[model samples]
Target: MTMRTFASMAKPGVTSALPLKEIPGSYGLPLVDSLVDRFDYFVTEGAENFFKTRIQKYKSTVLRVNMPPGPPIVSDPRVIMLLDAKTFPTLFDLTKVDKRDVLTGAYMPSTDFTGGYRTAVYQDPSEKTHGKLKAFCFEVLKMSRPRIFPEFTKAFDELSVEVEKEFENEGKASFSDKVDDLIFNFLCRALIGADPVAPGPASLGNSGPTHLKTWLAPQLAPIASSGILPKVLDELTIHTITLPFALVSRDYKKLYDFVDTRGSALLDVAQNEMGLQRDEACHDLLFHIGFNAFGGMFILFPSIVKYIAKAGQDLQREIAKEVRGAVEANGGLNMKALESMPLLRSVVYEVLRMDPPVPLQYARARKDFMVESYDAQYEIKEGELLGGYQPLATKDSHVFANAEEFVPGRFLGEEGEKLLEYVLWSNGRETDESTVDNKQCAGKDIVPMVARLLVAHLFLRYDSFAVDESSSSAIFTQLTKAS
Candidate 1:
C-alpha cells in the first residue's frame, strides 16, 4: 500500500507544486504536553480556536499536535493535523491509512457497549469482518429506501404539529428537541418496521432516544465535552479518564433487547444471508440505527434549520418557492420533485459543508506515506495517528469563496456542482460512492434525501420562520404560513 500524491487525492489545482517541509509543532513533554493541550482544547481555547491558534503559531495547515482524551485513555495523543481540503482526503484512502480503532479518534469504546462485538465501525477494510458488515449495512439501507420518504413525511408531519402547538401555547418551540424525537421515530419505523412511540416489541416509548444518549455519552465523553459541567471539571473527568462502560450497561442492554426483538428480520438477513451471528447482527443493527442514523440526524437536521434560520427570509423565500414549484410541477413531493429543487438540495449540501455532523475524522498511516497541504508535504510514518478537522477543511477559503457565510445556492449550477467533491460530511467525499472497501457512510444518499425532505416539508407547511440562536438549539419564535 502506498500514498497517492496530493494532486491525485484532491481536485485539480487544489494541490501545490511546492517542495516538502518538515511538520511543525511538537507534543512538548509526553503526558504533560497532552494534558495542557487537552486543557486548551476543552477548557481555554475550544475546538476551533485550539486548531486556529496552532495554525497561526506553526504557519502551516499540516502540523504535529496532541489531540484530546490523551494519556490514560489513549496511549498517545499525537496526530498530524490535516486541516486543509488538499490533505483531508488522505484519510479516505485505505491503501495508506488504517482506520481500525480510530473512529472516535484516539480512543474506542468498550465492546461491552456494543454487545461484545467490535461492530462494523471499528473495523478497517483490511479486516475480514469489514466486508460482511459493511455489505449488510448497505443491504439494510436498500431495504429501507421505499419507506424512507413516507416515514420521513409521517414523522415530520408529527413534528410540525408539535412545533405549532408549542408556538401557539408557549410562543416558541425548541426545534432541536422536536426534530430529535421525529428522527428517532422515523429511523425506527423505516429501518426496522418498529416505532419507539407505538406499542410493540420496539416500544421503548419516547425514552428511546434518552436510552441511546445515555449509552452513547460515555463512549464519546473521552473526546467530547457535555458543556453541562464546568470546563475544568469536564476536562479532568470525562476528557482525561475513560468512563466505565458498566455505568451504561443496563441502558445498552435495554437497547439491545429492543433491537433483538424488533429487528429480528434484519437479524435473520444478517445471519442467514450475510453469515453473521444473530447477536452480532442485533448489535450492529442497533449501532447503525441508534448511533449512525439517529445520531447523524440528531446533529444534522437542527444544523440545517439553524443555518437556514440565520440566513433569513430572503434565502427561505427562494427555497420555499423552488420547493413549492417543484412539488406542483411534479404533482407531488416525491423523488422527482426533490430532483427538480436545486436550491433545496444546495441548502442541505451547504449546511453539511458548514457544520458536518461529525467534526473530526481519524485514520492511522498503514505505511510510510507523504501527505501534502498547499505549500508543503509531510512524510507520515507507519502507525502514526492522523486527524482531519473537517469544518476547517470544508471552509477552506481557497476552495469556497465566502466559505464562512451561509450561501444556500452555493452548490447550485454546473460550477457549484463540481464543488461537491469538497463536501466530506459523510466520511467520504460527497462525490465519492460508498462501498464496503471504503469508510464512506453506507446511507450517504439516504441522509441527504431525508434532510431535503425535512426542509421541503417545513417550507411547504410554513412560508417563513424566525429562530432565536442565542441558545445552542434553534428556537422557532415565528412561523408564517401562506394564506
Candidate 2:
C-alpha cells in the first residue's frame, strides 16, 4: 500500500488542523490500579493484547496507560502509549524527547549492573559522555569490520561441526547453546580484539554468553514476563518486584575484569585519544557488547532459524540456490555477494519485522508538543514518558499489505525496500543511518550483515534444516542431507 493510501485509512478528514485532544486512558488508583494493570499485562492479555484492548476501548491509537512494575520500583507507572506507525517515530526525535532513564521505561536498572556507570544506551544524545561513548562504540565497530567476517565464518564453521555431530549422533541438533557460544566468540574476537577463549587469566572460554545473561536478567526482571512460571506467581515474583544487582555482582565483575584486561586496546583509545576515563570506558564497552550487541543476537539468531525452519523446504531451497549463486557469481561470500542476494536479505528483514529482539522503545518528552496518530492529534506534556510496542506498530494494517504473514521477499526490490523505513527494531528506521548523534543502535548495520552471513553459511553447508518448536524450547529437529 502507498503512503497516501494508508493516510486514507485514518479517520476521514482528521487532518493536522484538528483540535488537539487530551490523551485518552487513565492510570486509575495508585497501587490497586497499577497492580491490576500489571497482572493483565503479564498474565491475562499478554503484551500485544494489553495495548490492543485499550486501543479498542479508547478507540484511539495514542492513550495513557500504566507500564509495569509501578510504585516503589518505578516512580511513575503511567506513560503515553504510541501504538501506530504515524505516532511511534516521535520517540526517535532526540530534540523533542529526553531518552535519559527510559531504557526499560520508568524502571531504571541500578548502575551497579554496569560497574557503577551508566552505559551509552541509557544516556541521551544531549549528554557529553554519550557522544564520546557512542563515538567509541562506532570506532570499535569500524576497527572490527575487517575481523567480523573472518571471526563469524570461523565461529559458524565450528558451530556447523557441532550441529552436524549432534544430528549424526542423535537425530537432531539443539542449536541454542551452540548458537550462544558462536555469538560470544565472534563478538569478542571482532570487537574486543582478542579471542574470548584464548589463553589468558581472563579467558571466558564458552561461558561468556552466560556471564552476560546473568548480568542482564535481574536488571530487566522488573519488566520481564516470559511466562516462565504460572500467571499469579510469575506476576508477583518477576514483574512487580525489583531484582537486586547484588545477585549478579560477582558474575558482572568477571565480565568487567575480562573486558578491562582483554579489551585494553580499545579502552586505551577511549582514554588517550577520546578523553574518557578508562574505568568508565570499560563499563560502557561491556554494556555495549555484552548487553546490547551480544544480548540482541542471543535472542535474534534463534528467531531467524525458527522462521526459516517454519517456512519449510521450498523456501530453504530457494534461499540456498540464491545465496550459493550470489557467492559464486560475486567470487566469494562478501559484501558484493550479500548485495547480489536480494532474497537472502529480504528473508532476514522479514524475520526482523515479524519478531524484533527489542520489542519496546521509550523516551520521555522534552517539552509540550502535539503528537499525531493515524486519526487524531494529542498534546503531550513535557517529561511525559512516551513508549511504543514496535511489534504492533510494524504490523499496522494501514502501512503493510500482509502485516502478519512472513513474506520472505517483502523487502526484495527498490519498491520493497521502501517498507524498511517502518522497521524500527534498531531504535530507528532501517533506512536511517546510525551515528553518534542519535540513539540508533551502533551495531545496526553490523547486526543484519552478520545475520545475513550466518544464514548464507548455513544454506551453503546444508541443503535445508528443520526445527521442532513443539517441545518446550525450539530445537533443530532435523536436517536434509548435507550438500
Q: Which candidate tops TM-score? A: 1
Cα lDDT for residue 243, model 2? 78
User: Model 1 misses residue 332 by how many Å?
Assistant: 1.5
lDDT of 2 by residue, 122-231 (tens): 99999889999999998899999889888999999989889889988999888886888899899889999888878787888777778888888888777775446787
Quick one: best lDDT, which candidate? Answer: 1
Range of the 10 consecutive residues with the lowest summed lDDT in candidate 1: 1-10
Candidate 2 wrongly placed segments (more than 4 Å): 1-15
Error of 1 at 355 (Å): 0.5
Report every candidate's CA lDDT. 0.87, 0.86
Write down the TM-score of every candidate. 0.95, 0.94
